[model samples]
Structure formats: structure tokens, C-alpha cells
Target: MTDTIEFASYIVERLKQTGVKQVFGVPGDYNLEFLDYIEKDPVLNWVGNANELNAAYAADGYARIKGGLAVLVTTFGVGELSALCGVAGSLSERLPVLHIVGAPSTRMQRSRALLHHTLNTPSSFTAFTDMSKQLSCSMALLNQVSPDTPNGYVDAFDETLRQCLTQCRPGYVELPMDAVRAVVSTRGLNVPLPDSHAAPSLEALRQLTPPGTPSPINKLYKDFGFFEPKPDEVTEHVVKIITRLYEGAQRPIVLVDACAARFGMGPIIRHLVEACGIRFFTTPMGKGILDEHHPLYGGCYAGRNSLQPVRDEVEASDFVLYVGSLKSDFNSGSFSVHIDDAHAVKLHSYTTQVGYAEFPTTDIRHVLPLLVGALEGVKSERPRVLGESLEQKMKQGRVATLVNRPEGTDIVHKWLWPRVGSWFHDNDIIVTETGTSSFGLLPVPLPSHASYNAQVLWGSIGWSVGATLGAALAAEEEPDKRRTVLFVGDGSLQLTVQEIGTMVRRGLHPYLFVLNNDGYEIERQIHGATAQYNNIQMYDHQLLLPFLAGKNPATPFESHVVRTQDELHALLLDDKFNVPDRIRLIEVVMPRGDAPEPLLLQARLTAEANSGH
Candidate 1:
């Protein structure tokens, strides 16, 4: 006789099997039953978020730090709609995030009655799922028990999850209100889960191999890894072109990009870089991809927008080998990075380019390991490394000088970033907002074992606040308990600031650096510097901790306001302030128009592009 279990238990069990330990979302009438199973499971922890959007952003951040998949739950219609942008960010950023929506019962849907969260139309029931289809790699609506899927919806859930992991992108599934209580065969629980894929051996993931160790995504990002390559687009052809370029060129360098950080290519890239002993550089999106302390790391390269030494080094190279490059306007310095197809070879998750030739062959996951042997022998013959560390130059007078500063001088972008870099602690998880913080953090040198998170490609304002909560939870769970720090502007913080309360409720201690610039500074650079449209109402940021946490909170918290350069310096140098024992919010006031150099450069290029130049 086959054993049986509720559908909700099966979903919870499958999630547990996939290595996910926590579920994030706000409880709604539709999802309350399912949340029960999550809470009851000893292994699964339910993180009740302030809102659905914040939940999705939290899920995205969690996926990034865990280096794998994450789970998000939501109620149908209103809840799911609120989360669309966050889920869209996951899709655009290529994060393996599974979004499960608790939908209305089949009976209620067939009746077509206007529900609280639904529109007054017959199509309202399916409209949300249809809208979500465009945002996810795969999706499934589980409402039946078919022979092919013996345990009702487990097989379909498993398949959709497999597709999400295979692509390392967002996925979707809808569970009806009644279906949560549907009886399914417990025997299916023993069958492998949505977590394991490709390997015939279920034990391999834990024993030796890992998941989503795919290639660095293509920096060009034209195909987004969906196109079928021609017969000539083979891996062998790419290997041939790369080997030839390396052997013939006097100066060839390795460049890593956004895909390198998301697709688990860090170790492989590092291994190849160390074995070859050649200098390497990263695109802005590719920061934290390798050990910055590595002598071979030649700071960030962004066309004319780069530092003088960095620009000189890359522009002077005879050949370039790019790994998972992303050349968006912001990432590429407004299309200023120019490279001859004949002198460069680009690698992607599912494609490879030999100069102008594109290979739609096996993805980077399969091709990258092979190159470890093919190119490890092609080290540079001459020393081409920059004379001094780019970060040191940025801090030690190249950008700003610390000496003889007026005590009341307000913090500026050029002067602030380098100082922040020096304050970074080992194993810190740095999260930067899409505005100034994102571009500004690029010049700062990260400490050993530190990881950087930025929504560079997506450029979503207010994303970092909620992301910090998820990243902090993930970091807290790690063996070393890495400290999570967030750099967000006061303007951007207004959008998703409610998550701050969520972080406090969860007892997570993250460093919140609120850059108070009075308004949307990034927007000011792009279009309206002094336009009233860019202005935002100001709030007393120093009171955020106490107000958000409520009275007599168990979580330790502190807040500070810095108006002068001297005060800022004193705070950063405080030993007690630097410790991660409590959640600290430092409100640093700055001039409204002050912005990072890269952001300014990008704004100028964008303006020219807009004017049809």
C-alpha cells in the first residue's frame, strides 16, 4: 500500500531536499495553510517579510550569497503583482529563484466570482500567471493527480525547478488554496527532489560535484544564451582561436565580468588566473569575482571611464580574453570600450566567441574546465602588471588627500569611497544600491574573503535595503558568520525601507550606510541636476533604528549622524563602532549634486545617445 501525505507537506519536503533552509514572504489568507507546513518543518524557517516586493528582493539576495537557489512565497494577484519587479530583477540578473504563489481554490476560480485580490473579469484567475510567464524561465500550476505525476504535483514542481536551475534564472509555480490540503502519495517523497538534476547519481551533489557551476554569462548579452549556434560554432573552434591569440600576442590579458560572479565561475577563473600568472581585470559588474589582493588583479576596466593606469593597461593590450562579459551602457562606460574582434575571444555560459566568430556549442560550464589544461601553459612572457595597486592609488592622493582637510568639509564621492575601502573588514558581505553606492564601491579595494553585491545590470532603486536582510541572514548562517554591510542613498532607501523592520525583527545585525544627498542624485546626473522632479522629502534617518524596531527591542541597535569630514573619520576609526555586535545605521550627509565619476560618465553618454548623436 502506498503511504499518503498532504500536498503542502510534499512541497515543504521537496524544498528541504533542495538545500533550502528558509522561506520568505508575508502570510496571506490564501497562503496561510501552506505556511503552516513550512513552520512545522523542523528544518525550514519561515521569514515573514514586511511586504511581497521586499520578500522577492530578499529571496534574490539570499540566492546570490548562498551560491544556489532560493524560495519565495506569495499570495495570488495583489501579492504576486507587487513582487513582479523583484522577480524580474532575478530573471534579468540570472538568479535561481523559485517563486511560489498561493492561488485561489479551483472551485472559486471556476465560479469566476470577483475576489478581493482579483479583477472583475473571467480571465482574472489566469491573468496573473500569464503575466508572470514572461518573467520566469519555467512555471507550473498544480491542481490535479495524473499518472505521470504519481504524487499529484511533485513531478511538475520537480521539472520546473530543474529548468530554473539549468538556466539559473527565476521560476514560478502556483498552488491553489484547496490543493494545499490535497492528499498525495508519500512514496513520492522518497523519489529524488526538485533540487537534484543531470546527475544520474543523487549523492554526487554532496559528495564531489555542485550545481549551477555554469559558465560566466556572455558580457555582450546579445543572445542571453537562447540562440542555436551554427555548425561551425563548436567548442574546438573557440579553443583554437584562443590558443592562437595567446601564442601570437605579446600582451594578452584576462577580463572577467558579471556572469563570472553569478554562475559559480569564480574558482575556475581564479585557478586559471593563478596557474597562468597573467594579470587580470574585471568589469564593474564583475567586482568581487576574484581575490582583489591577488597581485595580478589590475583594477576595473571601463573604457575612458577607468582610472588612468587601468585605462592605459587595457587599451594598450594586444589581445583580450573576456570571461562572461556584460557590456551594457553602464558596465561598458557608455559603449566607450572598443575592441577589435580579431584580437579578442569572449566566453559565455552557452556560447563562445573567437574574435568575430560565435559558437553556439556546449555552455561555459562544459567548455571552461577544458581550457584549464589548454591555456594554463600560456603565461605572459613579460611583466605587464600596474606599478602600484589601483586601490592604493585611489586612496593615497590620486583621487583625494586625507591631510589638512577642514573639520567641517562635507564628504564627496572621490574622497569618500577610498576611505570606505580601507574600513572594509575581512569576510564582509558588501551590498551596494544601484545609484551612487554601486558605481562608487568599484574603486574601493575589498578585504580578503569579502564578497560584493550590486544590481548593476538591473539598476533598480531601493533594491539594496531588502537585499541586505536576505544577504545578512545567509551570511549569519555561514560558519564564520560574515558581517553584512549595505551602502544605500537616502533617496533610494525610501522605497523599500520597511524591510529594515524585518531585519530588526529577525535579529540580524547589518551595517546600514545611508548617504544623505537630499534627493535622487543618480537621476540628477542622468537628466535633471537641479530639476524639482528629482527632489524627495527628507526624513530623520538617525531615528530609523528605534522607530522601526519598536520600543525596548531585544535586538541591539544604534544610529549616528555625520555632517562633517572629521566626524565621519572619527566614526569609521572607532573600534567599538566597527564591531558587528549590533545593527548600526550611519547617516552621512553629503551635497545633493555630488556623484561618482562613472555615473557622471554614463549620464553624459546616455544623454548623447538620447539626442540621436
Candidate 2:
């Protein structure tokens, strides 16, 4: 119909149709033609990067925020190889990323003999293919071999891409140079893409119940050195305990963590939260599934760093329910709260296992929904606000602390949270690093998709910046009205700071706030001066310069060093710096030896022990 769009152009069209606003990668001689066409294609934005690693990282971020497949393109050889770290990370995290690599032209393959930029053999491609198989269990290979129907390449390629995305969530496809311009018969290339697979059948769900815990599952739990309770016997008991808690508490709240989304129990959990009119809040890792903006949302309920208003709400509530949430340090603020000692009921997969009780660990996907259904006749009072003024008091205290910073000082954790919170809207997304930034900045108070990626199972540093990029990419696909924000520590920033270059090159504008606390403050706080070895050599604070590339690369972003409260006060009031065309980097120097809240410390210890510490 339209002169049969070129294969590369068709790719741009299809990705655009899937709501992909941009693709991240570098241009090279092998894929010059493809890159040329992409430059002129308005439907797709080519996010060029300094290195393949950052390109992949940026794509990961974009995918996490966008909630779909993010494409990262690279030249053959080293460029392709550099993407492995990020691809591996994506696979481990279960994020969908499309890696499209450009190989030497098909016609020149015989003559190249593993030319300068080419691999000695197809082994490199084979390795990537293997990684794809291991990561997603789906694969696609194309190299312009079909002469009968040149367009068959595009059709086959598109179909495979769809399968990888819907089924596995992460995929890899390699394209040779000659195939970029392949022209195939247009007869059936225009067929609409297939729909996503249907939901699992109701009958299939019913059959999931068992007369007793399966031995394999039992063996699996035992191997983990976990004490397995009688899951089948306790399911009823736990459901009753939760139903009673709902009946007794005037203001009951349920906290769901990453388990809800990973196990696919979001719908059921939301139904229960609504049916019982209980307030709900998800840990940063569990922000999706149950939209945080929903009225039933109570916001992330951390203590000190809890959003000003939300903290008040949490303090006012008499009961806290742990549903699909492990009592990890990140969730409990480092074991700060006495969860096992608290009067709340904890409902995980199978058993209503009381706090610290030996319980059968079950998959929440099968358990939560069934558990919710089992409580149909158990009526309960709607969760109510016990103290209307509590939120107001918290808000006032937080505002005073944030708006006024001490003079001639680096940023403190407490002062930073409120200002950052002010910049975010109800639906904006946040991904925070683990260092002081994670320890200091409590989850923002707003109702948005915020993921606290600082590892809970372990205190992993340098996880947030990359994770933020991933979470942002994941959140981007939700709808038009969403933006991603990253809060990182100076120490954590050093670990993955290369991503800044990736960000600028890809034209991805995320608001990055780095807590420039001079050195490893968190480690110092924990281990004291005896941990002097934790110090890292510093670099020029502005690291975005090396990555910005284009025919006419204009440095449109701004980075400022804020020392006093006055400077922060002046900056927040200025609205012009928040535009998408520019990136605003605020480096707030903070006092050394400041530890993350004690709540986090306690939570971390509890999580460590439970995680087989």
C-alpha cells in the first residue's frame, strides 16, 4: 500500500506502534544505513550513548519506566560485548529489554575474515543468543537469507520479537547490514500483531490447591534451611487471623512488597485491600500493580523519612498488616520497628504465620487471591483515620526542616527529602540508591510509583542509579503523564556514574540528585574511623561531559553545588530548571558520620537473619 516500507523503516514503525518513544545505542559503520534512516524517522528517537554498557543501562531505565520492551542498539564486536553487564542485570531483575545489534553486511561476510571490528567467528553472536535463551527462554535470529520473500525477514523478526516480549520480557535480535534495506512482498506484512496471551484459566487456578504440601515444595523449603509449617493446615488458620484483625482494628493497613508483583497477585491483593477498606502502601520495590495514586493508597509508611503527611497517617493507624511483604530491613527501616512484637497480623503465601513464627512459605500468587476469596463472608469495619491532625503536624515539621538549610553546609538527609518531594507529582516515579541517600531520604510522601531499590535482602551499594534508570524505563510506559527521578549518594554514584553519560547521549532527561557527602559516610557511620579504607578517590563532580554526543551537541543541562539552606531555598523556588530539555544536578554536601535511621538498621538485621544470614 505504501510502496512497502523499508525493513528498517518498518522496524521504526512497529516499535513506535508499541509506544517506544526512543531506542538507546551507538551508531557504527555496519549499521550506518539503518542509523541514517532512523535519524530521519520522526516516530523513533535514536538515543546515542558513549558506551554500550550505559546505553543498555539507559535502555533498562527507559524500559522499567515505560513498562515495555526497550531497544538498545550497538555495533558488532566490542560495542555489542560491552552491553553484557546491563543485559545480565536486566535478566536478573526480570525487566524486558530488546538488544538489536548491527553486524557486518551479509555480502561482505565472506571477505571480512573477522575484520577489525568483527568477531573472529559468530561465537560472540552465539554467546549473546545463549544469554537470551537463559534469560527469557525465547530467541530470534535473522540475517537476510530469504531471497524468495525478502519481507519475510521483517515478518518473522516482528513475530519473534512479540513472543520474546510477552513471554520472557527480555529479548535479543541481531541484524546484518544488508538486511537493513531488505524489501519483501507486502501481501501479509501488514497483519496486525498478535494479542498478549490470555490470563490463566480459572480451572487451572482451582487445581492449584492441594491436599497437603507437595514434597518437592517441601524439599525446596528444607533445602533453604527454612522451617516449613503445615501450609495446607495453616491456610485456614491464617485467613481467620487476618479476618479477625480486620474486624478488630479501626484503622488497619496492609503493606505489600515486591512479592505481590513478582508472583502476580496484584489484582487479588487490591481486591482485598478495597473489600476490607484497609489502607494500602507498597514498598518502593513493589510500587506497581496497585496504583499508588488510588484513594485507598496510604503511601509508603516509613518512620522518619516517611513522607510528612504519610508518616502522620502511619503513626495514627493502630494496626499494620504485612501481606506478601517480607519483614526486611528496607521495609521495616532496618528492623527499627518490632514487627514480630507489633500487634499486626502477617499474611504471606500459605500460612498466616505470626511474626517470627515458623510458617510454610507459599507462592503468594496462588495464596493471596484464594485467601481473599475465602474471607468473603467475614465482614469488617472500614479502616478509619484515628487522628486527623497527626498528618498536619508532621507536614509542618517536615516543611520547616526542608525549607531552611544551615548556612555554608553540605545537604543533610532530612533537609533533602521535602524539597525533592516538592518537585514530584502524585504519579512521578522515584528510584533511590542505597548509600546515605537510601539511608537518609525516606520514601517520598506523594502517591506515585516509587521503588526503593537499595537492596533489602542485603545492603548492596551502587544499586540505585542503575536501578533508577531501570525503574524509570519501566514506569515510562504506564501513560503520558509520568516522569522518572533518581536520588543517588556520592559513593553509589561513583559505582555507576557512567550512566550519566548514557543518559545525556540517549536524550533521556531524568532529574538526578546526588548527595555529595565527600566520602563513604554511610560506611563511616556504621564502622566509624576504623573504616577509613572506605574512602574513594574523587573525580570532577560534573561527569556528564564525556558522554554528550551529536553533530551539534549542545550542553543544555545545569549542575549546581549547594552548601547552605538558602541556596536550596532559592533553587526550589525557581521553576525554570525543571524542564525536560535540561537536567538539573543538585549536589548537596552532607555531614559525615550520619547513619541511616536506626529503624533501617533493625530491619536490615532482621532481613539478613531471615534471608539465611
Name the top TM-score candidate: 1
lDDT of 1 by residue, 190-268 (tens): 7654321121221222122123443322322445656533323455566766786887787777899977766678888
Please identify model 1 stretches exceeding 4 Å from their true place: 1-3, 144-149, 186-233, 378-388, 392-408
Candidate with top lDDT is 1
What RMSD does model 2 have? 7.8
Give the worst 10-residue stretch by lDDT in candidate 1: 200-209
- Please, what are the lDDT tens digits per residue for candidate 2 over residues 112-171? 455667456766335545555555434456753564665567766775676545432567
The TM-score, computed over Cα atoms with residue i paired to residue i, of candidate 2 is 0.68
